[model samples]
Target: MGNEQSKEKEKHVFSTHELVFNQLNEAPVYCFDQNVSSEGLAFSHSNLKVRFPSRQDQFQVAYLNAYLQLGHVDQTLSVRARLEDSVGSIAVIGFGESNTRSHSDLYLFDVTQRKVYLCGDEVPNVRLPVCGDGDIIQFQVDIGRGRLSYQIINSASSKQESATAGDRSLVTFKFDSADLPHSVRPLFGMRSTSVTEPSFHVLEVSRELSLTDKALFDKESIYGPVTLSNDCLNISRQDIKSNCCALIDKVLREGTHRWKIRILKDVGASTCLGIAKHPFYVPNMYGMSSQHMYLHSQLMVWRSYGGSLYSSGSKLSHELRPLDYDDKPVTVEFLLDLTAGTLEIIREGVSLGIAFKGIKPPVQPVVVFYAGCEKEVQLVSFHSNAPSGNNDDPILLKQSGSKRSSDRVTKKHKKRISYAFDRSMTYGSLLISPDGMTVERRQSHIGNAYCLINQTCSTGVYNWSFKINEDQGASICLGITTEPVEVTNDAIYESKSMYLYRSYMGKLYYNGRELRKEFEEFWMPGTIVELILDLVNGVLQILVNGINQGVCFGNLEAKAYRPIVCFYAAMPKSITLLKFEHFPSEPKAMFVPNNLNQGMPFQSNGLSEDIEKGIQRTDRCMVCSAIDGNVVILPCKHAVYCAAHAVVGEYCIVCERRIESIVNVF
Candidate 1:
């Protein structure tokens, strides 16, 4: 029985099919000798027996996933993922082998260099953050593309915990893999003389990686009290005394591009929209820094060069200034034509031609918020007109100049959604109307008032419209709370049971922590506020005055959630629930993929952005090409198979991995 249990444990050990470290009693050494454990491979003055894949499997696409353990980590430590021929490769087993023949097409993460190197060449455009102990490193060899890419993530960052594909925090580099031999092997070499030498623990042998869309804001570049929504395209902040800044993840090196920013509120001069070069200080949160230019609402152009602010910033012509409208929210467009060495500002499709001239390339669009400003902004549209093969191809403006259209789900279902304030859950100060549509806070109540909706949202998409009689300054905290919630003032941020959008600060709070994601629209008087709870995909979004505010929170718990509202002051004005709409189906499930062929590559026609936003699970099955995909592939967690196709293959067609199990959702 003991021997049988040991054999079961060995079955789960991650390794190539050609090598089983636990079965061998003697270690194989070609150079620096190191014994291999079933747990991982440690590189030091020790010998490890690791075998490369056989010649038949050499061209197959595989992913090498591992956790890099840093030892005595500092500027002197280094690690390399080298590609070498399987036959008679001396550098594969040698430590710090300087011979060029053994290190063909190698990628190195060196602490001393402060840069990632691809085959001894410095990787372009990718920034290398500081690496610490227990960081994750993944190497991908794409046989179809004939390319090799390496990605590394710092363990200390919150991004390491995310399973989302195409995470921008990962430092990645890709190069041609054509030079690799038929029996190529990915070997690891490290500087390990100390007691705590870095090691690589094998997690998986093979997997496919998803592509990235460089359209959203870079979460890593954000600083201060700013909150980003709409997949980081919308930026907002609370009324605060300090400034904050954020930028798009893509760098505008060289190309003709155009993007639009819609001001959701009248920010006046408190917010500045502009562009800045690389290596700018973000703590100051200044839009007009060295090599930067910004537009203020007061018809002033803030300009800086060579780390110096312009002496006469307001001297720019008034015609070049952005046009102001009486409407509450205004849309502003920026046309950056690097080919013409100019930047143009457009308002309402009117050209404020050539706001700045003789400008160079390699700058990022930035938004800065000053002290004591309550503002909300969204990147409504972006386009690129650059030709192919440009330095900014990924971010180039589309030549046709088309904008991203809203794909908001609006279809109605057979079941209608209806809910009202739960009188049983209402606080003492709050009064429910006879019709149960309006709730008023009595003037006699002093501390707080609370109310909950009658229905519990467990599945499907739901939208509830709300309206306030007046903008009673900073009086409401409203959002969703988990089940078994009590009527208490401290319940807002206390037990991680609720996610609230505080009208007092225009910010979001959850579990005693202030999230960087804020509500992009203000809660004004007499305007319709729609709270969209998509239980199908586990996301919460807001729409003000019929305009969507993108997703405020994602990956919400699958537990029963109740809508809640709280008033902090005694106000006679009543808050009313206008309407409720429910669609008892997933957004992706309604529309099936055109051609669901088995083993066919999934083509993303810009719908990948939606797929990444919790819509990766599809309803179309590959085998029968039906829309009844309910079975989810285990381990990969991909729900692309229908009931019939679920048991058809031993491997998942999407990720090309062995199916460990299958479970039907819903």
Candidate 2:
């Protein structure tokens, strides 16, 4: 029984004749050292061992480079492998025009300076600590266009502790196999001073990778071609002009079917790769938001620069910014599921977690490449994993943690926020536009309120700005506070208030005392007033027309705070609230105050700004007390708005006291 098992370990003969492994023994599956014998190479402990390690220069006795017998075609391939805990380098042992190892190509943990090389370039020295603990190394190869691309990843980190597709790995990145053969062989080599022969080594070869497209591009074509071939549909880099780069016809079924488009390229440079339900056409990443999905009457999800995924224009996963991708071979995949109304992203076989959910149905892959870009984005393949459009049918999906778009966005600003208006928190006479980008005070009364969906995380600058569209003096107090505000009340800066405010005079008032002053006079209309909470300096800086006003108020602690805007304007005018912005752009938009001061001012501004009986309230609505209170806001608890004026801007008209965060709520 032991002898027969040893024979089985000697080799694995497959029916497809595409792969052949020598199991854990000696000899090469494809190539063997001229001086090495079958008995010279042995598997001891859990590592490969040569008969003699001191004889490093003596042929087969000291070194052995064994190649797998399995042969792969010049297309896309996925070969899953597991590496035992060893500091010594083991080359997958194949190179263009040669199959050998050099000291420079030793895969290192600290990525090398010459990390990325094209065809005829040296092998990459990769070092991944994740692989130090016997992790799954998803070794993938793509052989096409007379070149080979290699990719490796740690299934552990990528899966987020989820059962890996197989095991674990150390490093991950995709690159072309330059100067390699069209029909290539696999290799497993062992070389190192710390190599141990303990445990066991295993290779789990899954299904072979094949192109789903009917045809591939003709490499011999000298001129650019866009026409289809008899067995293969053809589209070249030249055919991609403007944003109309590539479009596959595999549309998915609504509520059931999900579709994915795979492109072997980098995802950045203003290009957008996504799935749309209709015949979509967009100019750029920004245009993709309003352009295609509207015409198709469905949802759209795409991947942009540095691996930043997006649904429409809003970002999905900012965690993997501009993915740690170089100009190597990458399988940029965009997955859209109608069953869950979600979209996911996968790069080089590494799962990037679920991107977006609540995406409406009917989707197809739409790739747009801008002209004059050097990035080669080829629509190499596509497929659908969904069943027919069955609302009752359930599909088995294993996805990483992703955010839900359908969840009440009031709690989350990064997903979607400025939808016509702050569904809640606007008071009487407040008119927000249809897109909620503009807010207007229709009534001359003194009780308009506005607040933004500011999810405070901490650190960095928290800011938002608005252009004085109409006139000034809604009292227009811009401040940061912890207490929830009401539009019926005045600009409360003191008396039990742990917040600060600044009127047109640019004076930071905390508890009725001027804590910090920026300007001596009131600000002019049409000037952009940027309210900035500099958490690092522990102060709030107000900027007018890009001019920094030093520090407004300091002593903000590390806690949740809101950006508030209250106004009982002197005139019935308007102000356009722009998207929430911050200095030194960061993907993480939370503002967690860390400098809580025990002596932070809490005194109120004393006198309230509410309308008295003597001040004649005119032009305001009778129900909500607004001149043109339009659109009923949905989210805030103290919601009060009429069904007439346009709902626009970020600040809540009623619950509008403090700046919640400095993220792009609009």
Candidate 3:
């Protein structure tokens, strides 16, 4: 039985070796190595293994039955080795079957780095009482993606008191094939004191590395060419031309370029001049400057130097003066070269003078008339120079002359505007005339006293109603009526006062108390009361039946408020307010305390002499009045017109031709 058992163990060990070798062959070339030996058996390119001591006393072994060594035939890479097993197997190995042994662990090795990653030296041995089986164990290793992994697992429970004995069922390990040495070997196996053998199956699979795939991928490999179409090119051209001039100016001002200028043409002429300047320094000389000027025509060149003083001013100060000289219009050309610090200007096939020496190369050349005295000017033509290499091809101006007709301009300024206040007209109706004058000649009306009652009640409950006049005054009449007494009561109450109150801007106004209260339900028969509200100038003027009562002055600050006049009626009859009037006072000038004539117009000494002589003979002339030599004028335009004979349209006042519009000048 012993010999039979030994033969069976040998067969199991040989099968394990075959399984490992076959597994290695099936996997990628970097899976295992064939140059590691243990005891009498050599573990070359193989899977992981675990072993135990044999019970046979005669056979004292130096190595265990289960062991493994792996290598990569195709690459020099590091491989991790480990063990794995089922959960039941782990429980059996962790806790002994009868609490005889402790737990089990795993061992790891990196063949490429040639170092032991983890040394699972001590493992517990255990046995399962129910199954009556000892712990089972195995190992695994994987190599891929420049990394390695390894693990170990015990499948059974074995109650073994030995320190290095446990039921380890399974193990796993992995590594990167790229980390392995191309012709290297792996060393891994078990050690024991007796001849014992364990069994294991090998696994091998190919793993594609994400890193390698990423390194080899290319986006352009899938898509083709990227080029703009003709339409796109045209669009780009339009955009460039529209913004290019301004962009060029900005670049020349802020960029390394030293100077820039815009030359506009004089009216009705085609010739233009553009000048630019650049500054440089010489080692031995003072700083020097260069000016590049463009003359759109030979006529312009002649006119510029001809000493004709058509316009006075230096080129820097004068604006673009019109050139009325007879000459063919010429387009301008521009050229700039930073390397040589030179700008070439050509117009109508003519080259302007090269300005190589100047005080500060004209950043912007002072424009001068083409044929007039060389005075500074501002306007220059856009066609002063065409872009280089493009001949005569007029760079169409992006912004043409205004399209609005001259007639329209004249018509817009000639119309008369008006404002109407009729209800048929829309609210806020303001019509502008072509002449730009505003005419507001219409008036809004406030009807009967009953209307006043409605207006007042609505104002108290809702919003107040008032007529706003353009002359800076408003009429507010409250809608309220008074009740009248009978004939018998009228005798005893000769006068009965009924008060009508209205509020404006935090203040209240009592228009008047009327004696007649006859028209309480309809239009009140009492006198109509109205107030001229001048909130702007802060004054309230009261009026009873269109008669001015008095004016009150105070601070009346409200967003929307007007002076309101109320009336009370003692008889039942319609009290009609003929018209709502708002007469705002005009501003007057006062003397400057010490000087009476400070704001008055000056008069000649001759006039003063004549006036003095005339004043002596005019005590009855009725056309002169002088107090402290300051004269007063009447409506007849008569200066110092006496009170008695200040006749209208009969005398001259300050040389006034018969008074058409009587204007009082103070």
Candidate 4:
């Protein structure tokens, strides 16, 4: 029982930590997107919310990255985000690491495709949960071990798969970082473009190493029947300390490899570990005379080992060494500098002061050999740097030569988008509904038409309203598309998604690029037009006052689209969004580790059945969790309620004062 308890205590536990984001105390630890001004943006190392007044220029991007250079990368790094934005605006939040956009190292979590991407390319036939409206996304990058993972951290939606769940990750991706060490600039950015000044706040950057990252010897990687997880190496049947042999497990390359080998069982005469450029004991392995380069071989002499020259069909004269070492494992480091063509041997973290120059290109077949056929010579940790490089480390990430962290993180309250009619998705008489769940346009006679935002629903059936209150000279085109267009003439303009317009001349558009056909569907007062768009099967149809208009557009390439309503200054036009199934719901990516020192868990994915039922029954404000849940914060478009409780202290309470305006829903 005591042994069992000890074994249980030795097992490594998994826990998350708080992230170090762009902080306020020090200089901005990251570089912001230059295309967008950082004026009204509120950012910290743990949280960030970007917003501003309606100026002439807003950052015309769906999402921007705050590129941070973590000078030296570790085994694993984690980042969490709580995305709050409109539909189709941000498909997914991307974590990229490269010098530039083109021909660079990029990792993207494609929300629409439900696939993770490396370098803008797809990750084959893998499918993961897509971030839905008001969802938290956790992003993790394990560079040394080569892993990237994400998890949806909210419990409100059908796709909520937070760390509190059994999986601990939504979707984990793998990539090779060994080849691209130079491309190590990780950036936090977004997908698509956001016309509105979207606000993002809850975030963190943290790291931790798993148990497998220890520097102890790996028995399986080494050849021969070795002991179970032991550092000692037995070269023969018995432990005779002379002429016994072994090789290091790490495979080093000529130019890009460095290793540190310790002399464990070094015998005085024949037990020594040294550099060799060919397979040990292989006859003519390199097809060269002296195993490609000079080493202590049976045919070569040992006295003159430094200073190079001379080649021939005849055997080349060479040298070797009775290497200097003691019974205590004397550490020796081998550095092969390919550019300068020199091999320097370092002893116990100190340079041995001996360098072999004139070592030119194509430095292949790198190996370290030990000769002790009768004796025993062991190689220990040639692939490591320090003598005992981080042994049995606890649950914490080793930072860059500084503060070690062991604090536990419990996520507090993270804001969820109050899904409703977006005020920013309107103009003139067109705007968000009073209830904040639909888009509405009041009656007007000017030749002005309001268009739904190009970003809304990228995939799935999109159902929208096309009502006509008092249609006087109304030229309204109601269809599903992702184009930002308004009808000035009696026709709909070409675009990327799809559209249908009804004026004196009714015209149907395919992909904003093709104008298919024309019909004479004139607008009438009290006419209820319902546009049903099936984006998945590539079919679009319309219902005129509960009457079906067959299939207007078919076989379309897959893409998310918003409902568009164009008005050419038509008078008396009042249209309200009756309802939307899954159309107008935005897709946000948010992630936050549980911070005990803060408030409640941010996404709260692991609530009890009763708690979940209570949450479902609750209709309170997102910030205060009170009952006034009915208002939309402007510029950001996140709805809220609780009038007196609305304004919390100096910060906007909900969005942390990242907005400039707040309007009642009703």
Candidate 5:
């Protein structure tokens, strides 16, 4: 138990302090300084003022020093000090350039012995232009290996230059007096030929390393093996000084274990690589090259849920046996090429899946490598095929089901009728009974000879109204009639009765007055006359009673057209039949008759009496002027009729016929 506890404790490891530096001071410490003139340059030592005195005085001047690892410093480097006067005078004292005549000479001194080594050295110098009254000069020193160089710049010109020794080597500088001018101040700077050491620390307790930190460190440095051990773990450094050979033997014997490895690189520094361990079911037996190596084990695996294996690949040619034929272990080998965006599966030296031509492979392979019941497995090796140059394509995974359906229906509706006439008629009377039945009438003759009520009339009636004789030119009377009228000429002419005669020779008359003279045939056979009964902006136009004759133009009066209910006819020489046809009913297109004078007059079948009751029931009696009293019912209950009314059954809305019966209602 104690050993186990110790082992657990040993899981953490610490590193030695490879290098150390003094706090130096929150305020910057004077490192080095130099003075320069046109004749030569000189180096000087710094005097550090201490806040608290030790054994001597509160102020002390010590040689500034730094400790570095072995081989850290090389030739061409040395340590030195520099000083500048208030008037822009400058000097340098150090381990190099101490000749008074040489422009590269420096003041030399030995601080431990308190002896002056070299003084008033003149080296190649650069003088800066003077500045304001109290302008201070600036100086800097470069140290490395066993050599040093010093320089200074004035406030005015602010230019700088370096000096060298006669032997082209380093020299030490010292001063006999320790006193400095009241107006002169020492300024220092340092430069080295050695590479700069990183200021980062590995063992900062405040900053604990996480998995991501470990991964990033492993990705950056090549000297350290990010380690986990019973005794010590160092992120960037490992020391095996005590048991180096023993540790090496142990590592060699145990080899590497197969585990997931995550390597993170600085986004601006390097590329990243990730590798995961294979399970026991998938065998990982692929060989490795120098650039690429297996992660750990020699086999990969994918465990099966029901001991059933499904094969997947770009194209499957044959079934592959498990790596462990006895089902003891199941695994498969797959190759991933980041640059080409491809993944290939190899089984038994045969290529089973090559999914590289397109995008990246899915998160996991379509087929599991080792699939039986194993919980853990191993991977032998892994390496990059290339630098992942630019695999622009993304991985695609297959789905299992179909997509959803849209919502709108897409069909059409059927049509009903065909060609239809769209025009208007003139001088024609349209009759609409109370029950929605409609009829049209036109007068074809004078003296009530021919009345085309609904497409039916006698020939003599049509002739007396429409045809006039050339010789003697019989006079004609015109009267408009919507109902069938009895034709009688020169026989039993009663008062207020319509008649046509030739008494005026060439004039037609209705009541002994000439209706039309020299008769241009106002009512001629096949003549179509249209009367504008009413017009309202040409929209609500009534050609006769219930007929809407659409829009019209031209003068109706000049055309011998009048709104009065009248007809046209000539004296008897020949009579032509006038026919009238009613427009079709509801949902049917309206028809405008062409020749009003040629329409046949309407005739009742003498069954008007029987149908009258049915017409009255439908309430389509139009001849009577009764507002509402005892109403007569039709057989169809659609029309009504009364006595003393000319019951035109053909024009009756009820029963869709003319009202022909006189029925008394209780």
Candidate 6:
């Protein structure tokens, strides 16, 4: 028995520290002028007048050298940590490096703000229980399972009240450990304002490097203003006036999915339950009127059209009666069939029938709350059947009783439209694969080359995605342009008529100007970029690695536009088309090839010689016969048009070329 006990002791380990100031190593101590007390286990700013250090307004950190072997087993650290505010500066206590520290490597708890942060970004929806000035806090690490959690008790408001309440209140926050650094040490940080300095204290510290059942919850699965249960199935919100949505991280693409939601806090008038495309970032509830489908608690069913881009195509059908919220816990059943494209709602064992139909795949379930609607809902049960693919059939979608059924669902049962690089339209240096799905530039190519998609888009939502097979230090550009726009060596980057997303700077550009600034460069080998062209809403959204980066452009015109890819590289590189999906729309191409005038004569005058020599173009409106011409037509590069005539003309009068776009020469 004694030998077995010795072996058990070797498997389990524990450590404790009194947090004495003198026993702690304070490296580069000049970062702050401080006073310390070993008996009290406290560190604070000194009252002595001295030269202010550069770290005055910033966080100064100190941690222990005794690193824990987190990978071996689960570990828990318990301590009494507290922050005393002096003019709103912050004090932090958590896990990180002691000697050299930054926000990126620190998993810290801000006592002043009452929030937990990992890599400088807040762990969304993790609640921290309210605590008094001083309370016991705990940090648990399960490195083998990639989970980290924080917990604190809700102490009473006063010392007298605390004795009676007995410390029952508790809240916990769980975070993904993938973003955490491998090594960690117990750490504390403090920041001081010029007027007053905040203080941080670790009254006691103890760790048990052994297994524990304290943390096994999936707490990080939801986002927004909501509280979740330990199982992460129940979500609740209260007292928030602004519109917010609790979006689940899971995407149900092609399957028959079913989930039961029990109303814990009766469904309010402002509550809506629905499914939306992933990365739904419409700021206001009104803006959410598009691109998503939902069932309002007020007996209404909303649907996203399979044809149009915006919510104007969204149909809302009124139910005969509203749900009876008087029932303490109303359980509502939601069934979605992607194979047949339908959604049915059932309440209290009664089927409400197919509430919605024609829903596309690749959507996520969401719950929207508005105007301080206090509500609590629990996902009691969830199930998804086999994958399905007939959701896009026009004949099946027309059964939704759509008023514009003929306009919305026109195409018959046909193969999904796929696009590839047009081999005949590519530059000399670029080589296209036999199937046209992949394109590669020759190793000898040292300059830029371009290629256009075989198909063009006009007035519907289209999704095009591609993968960078090999980058080879190349600068890639992906965007759309008019059909007539010339694809010169540098036209993709410099053309005023094209909208481009440049990979080199990770920014959007248009008309030779930067559209938006992005910090992270996203173009590299194996990176997949997806673009959504919503023509009806005039918006273009880009997604990288299955994450939507929001709208890149919001002013697209109703003209023929072809997807263009161009790159400049010193060595050969390859790109492959991965997926393509387009919604049906009326065909409208502004550029007509047969309308070009190859030999148009210019007016004989002193400027005629200069025009022929490419010195200057004409300054007369060929359309309305106006001399104050200031508009330049695209493709043929004719400048003989006034501003008013250019805006309304269908084609350039000089070259008789279809006018894709016009530039005002102000």
lDDT of 6 by residue, 55-90 (tens): 264566655433443332355544444433434456
Per-residue lDDT of 322 in model 3 = 35
Model 2 CA lDDT for position 452: 46
Which regions in candidate 5 have their CA more than 4 angstroms from the true location?
1-150, 155-337, 342-666
Q: Estimate each model's TM-score.
A: 0.30, 0.26, 0.16, 0.29, 0.15, 0.31
State the lDDT of candidate 3 residue by residue for 568-609, as single tens digits: 232211122223222222211110011111123424233433
The residue-by-residue lDDT of candidate 2 on 165-201, one tens digit each, is: 2323333455544434323333344443443431213
RMSD of 2: 26.8
Of models 3 and 5, which has the larger lDDT? Answer: 3
Model 5 gets an lDDT of 0.23
For residues 1-666, could you state the per-residue lDDT of candidate 5 as single tens digits? 999966774443222231111221111122322111111212221212111111221112222222111111111222222121212111122332211333223333322122232224332332222222112222222222222222222122232112222321223322322121111122121211223211111111110011111111111111101222221111111221100000100000111111121111111111111222111111111111111111113112221221112222111233333233332333345565534644455543566555233332222211111111112222323223222322111111011111111000100111111111111212322221111111222233233322222222211111011211121232223332222233344321121233232223323333333332232233333221222221111110111111112212211111111111222233332322111111122111111111111112222334344443323231222322122223343333332333444343533322233344434543
Model with the higher lDDT, candidate 4 or 5: 4
Residue range 257-313, candidate 4, lDDT tens digits: 465654554343333233333222211111121122222231111111232212211
- In angstroms, the error of model 4 at 285 is 51
- Where does candidate 6 have its weakest 10-residue lDDT segment? 24-33
Best by TM-score: 6
Candidate 2, which ten residues in sequence have the lowest lDDT sum?
392-401
Query: Candidate 2's C-alpha lDDT?
Result: 0.40
Give per-residue CA lDDT, model 1, range 45-116, as digits (tens). Answer: 212223333323111121122111111111111122222222221111111212234434444544323455
Candidate 6 displacement at residue 554 in angstroms: 3.7
State in Å the error of residue 234, model 6.
26
Scored by lDDT, model 3 comes in at: 0.24
For residue 462, give model 1's deviation from the true position in Å.
Answer: 1.0
Q: Which candidate's lDDT is highest?
A: 6
Instruction: Indicate the TM-score of model 5.
Output: 0.15
Separately for all candidates shown, the number of backbone clashes (residues 3 or more apart, or on different chains) is: 12, 83, 125, 50, 146, 0
